[model samples]
Every structure is written in structure tokens, then in C-alpha cells.
Target: MGTKKYRRDTLIEAGLLFSLFYLPGYLFLAGIPDPRSFNSLLYNLQIWILLVPQIFMVIYLMHRDDLLDFQSFGLVRPGAKDIPFILLAAAGTAAVVMAVQVTIMLVAGEVLPEEPLWKLTKYSMIAPVFISSLLTGYSEELFFRSYLYTRLEVLDTEKWSRLIFVNILFAAGHLYEGVPGGFNAFILGCYFSFLFTRKKNIHIPAILHGLYNFSALLLTLFL
Candidate 1:
């Protein structure tokens, strides 16, 4: 296929993948007594159930993209130089997120409440959270950066337009989190997209993404 045709096909595939992951969550949230309420176990359970399908869809999409090739996914040893930078970026991002969360709580003059906080720190939950972060980091990078951005680059005919389109979709995916979260995620997505385009690797962004989520979980627990 021509590059343009390939990219258009890839974008359609990505849209389908995103819809599979998000539609059910939207439906579940629709039924909630208070969509934003953190008090209901049933609501939480529904969210968790929605995540299962999302994860599976991500895996299938990544596999289809050939981005899940063991070496590409960081299953092999990375160069020594790449390792240190990746570690530093991940750690730095996590620290910044923690700082932001603390600032928010202080400004709000209230805590995150016990139940949701406990969900983050509980020993049994730690393993699952870590695994989920790792998987999600890999999956999102594969879909958004490797597949979607690469395809956009092929189709847009102009570099800046490709960047803008990719960032918009990246931001849109985070809309469920509210405006601030979507904006922040979009800004972060731009950074990651730039990194991927420059470095020609997904490992760094995956590490950063994982660390960002892990840091958010830590704030949920300890702050």
C-alpha cells in the first residue's frame, strides 16, 4: 500500500481500538448515581470490569501493529546510555507529579478521603497497580506513539499538522478525567511524541508514562 493509504488504515484501526476501550466505560459511568463519587464499591467494580476489555483491546491493537515485537517492546536489554536517561526521566516525572498532587491538596484544604486512599496503598492492591501501570504504559505508547503518530506523519503531508492532530487525539482520550487532566495529558503527550520522533524509540516514553501513573498512585496513598 502507499504510505498515505497505510496511514489512513492505521488511523481507522486506532479509532476502532479506542472505541472498544472507552465505550463501555462511558456506558458504565452513565449508570452511576454520581459519576464522580468515589464512595461506591459497585461503581468501582464497574470501572475495573471496563478496564479488562480495554487492556485486551490494547494488546490486540499493539500486536496488530507489529510494535509488540519483543525487541521493540523493551523485552531485550537496552543500551547502557538509554537506560540512565530513561530512569532519570521516569523518576523526575514521578517527583513532579507528587509535588503537583501535594500542592492541589494543600490548596483545597482537604484530604483524598480514606477509602480511595487506602485503595492505593493496600498491600494486596500494590502488585495489581504496578502491573496495570506497566501494561498500560506499554499499550498506550504502542497505540498513540508507534501506530497513531507514525501514521499521522505519513498522512498529514506537513509535519506540524501531524503533530497537532496526534496531540488532539491524545488529549481527547483523557477527557474522562475532566478538563485539567485532559489538558495535562495532552501537554505530556506532546512531549512524549517529540521524544519518540527524535529518539526513534518507545522505551523512554513507556517508562515515563508508567512512572507518572505510579506516582499518581503513590500520591493517592500517602498524601
Candidate 2:
């Protein structure tokens, strides 16, 4: 039946999205260098190369599943009012996350690492982080929350189930950051998911994501 077929297709698409995002982190954990390392240049380049092909593959898969809508993937233009708020929220969220990170390090008596904090100060590093953040945040949101959540919504699924599923996958994708980072990412994913569900706009969440990364970049520089 068409109903059963639709359900099957939805499951497959969700699975693919989850795997595309998380598998790289798993590989990285198997032994990727810290982004602050001298060899981080080579490490980041390899990850970017791997990411591009997966991106195209996800796009194709989403298109095939009929979930590739403009708004869902953030292709829709943002309004002027949306821009300012998004930027402000992004900045605030980034600041808060950095504060928390610092507090944690202070409490643990772990002195901040001396290496260059941002990979973007160098040309080779800039390309990967910028492209990776934009693409990964935009595309992943489209696949996980926008496309997948929309389908789940139509299916009359429970709200909590939707939130948990999407958040878990989102967190799982950051597992390469280690257990602490993974836990933090998972918690943040839940917060962002709530924001998305309430606002029904990807700009807010995307800006928040960018802000978080930008904050981390600054912390590396000044901490």
C-alpha cells in the first residue's frame, strides 16, 4: 500500500541522514587529531573532502524522498527583522556556551591549551571550518529537523518522540568531540530543536549554530 511505502521511505531517509552526519564523527574518534594541532591542517582537509561527497549524496537522497523543499533546507531568504534577532541570539548563545566551557575548565583546574584556538586564522583551515559549519548546520537541520520532523508531524507522532529522535541523532553526530562534547552537543540539540519547533524558522537555529562555533573560535584565541 502507498501508506506503508511512504512509511518505509521515511524511515530509510531518516536513517541515511543520521548515518551521513554521525559516521564521520565515528571515524574521527577512531583517531582524528584535535583541531588545534599542527597536523590539524591535513586532518581537516581530509574531513572536508569526505564531507563534500556525502553532502551531495544526502541532497540526492532527500530529493529522491520528496523532502528537498527550499524552506526546509534554509534556501528560503530570511527577512530583515529575522536577521537582527538571529544575529543577536547567535552572539548571546555563543557567549553563554563559552562562559560555561570556561567555568568547567576553571573548576577542573585545566589550564587552557596554548595552541591557536581557531583553525580559521590560516587559509587552509579557514576553508574547511567555514564551509563545514555552514553546510553541516544547514544541511543537517534540513534533513533532521525540517524534513524529518515535517514528515513525523504529518504522521501524527508524539511530540516527545520526535524531539528525542532528532536530538539524539544530532548529538551522535558530534561524538568525535569526545564524551563531554557529545553530551553538550546533545543537550544543545534539544534546546535548538525546541526553538525550531516553536519558531518554525531555520534562521534562528542556524545563527545560533554559527554563533556557537564563532564563540569557540574566540575562546581559543583569547582564553
- What TM-score against the true fold does each predicted structure earn? 0.66, 0.71
lDDT of each: 0.61, 0.62
Q: What lDDT does candidate 1 reach at residue 113?
A: 36
Candidate 1 has which clashing residue pairs, if any?
A: none
Model 2 segments more than 4 A misplaced? 27-32, 37-48, 56-69, 72-75, 95-128
79-112, model 2: which lDDT tens digit per residue? 8878776766666565556665676576655434
**What CA RMSD would you report for each candidate?**
5.6, 4.2
The runs of at least 3 residues in candidate 1 whose Cα sits more than 4 Å from the true structure, single-residue gaps closed, are: 1-8, 23-77, 91-119
Which one wins on TM-score?
Answer: 2
**Cα shift from native, residue 189, model 2 (Å):** 0.8
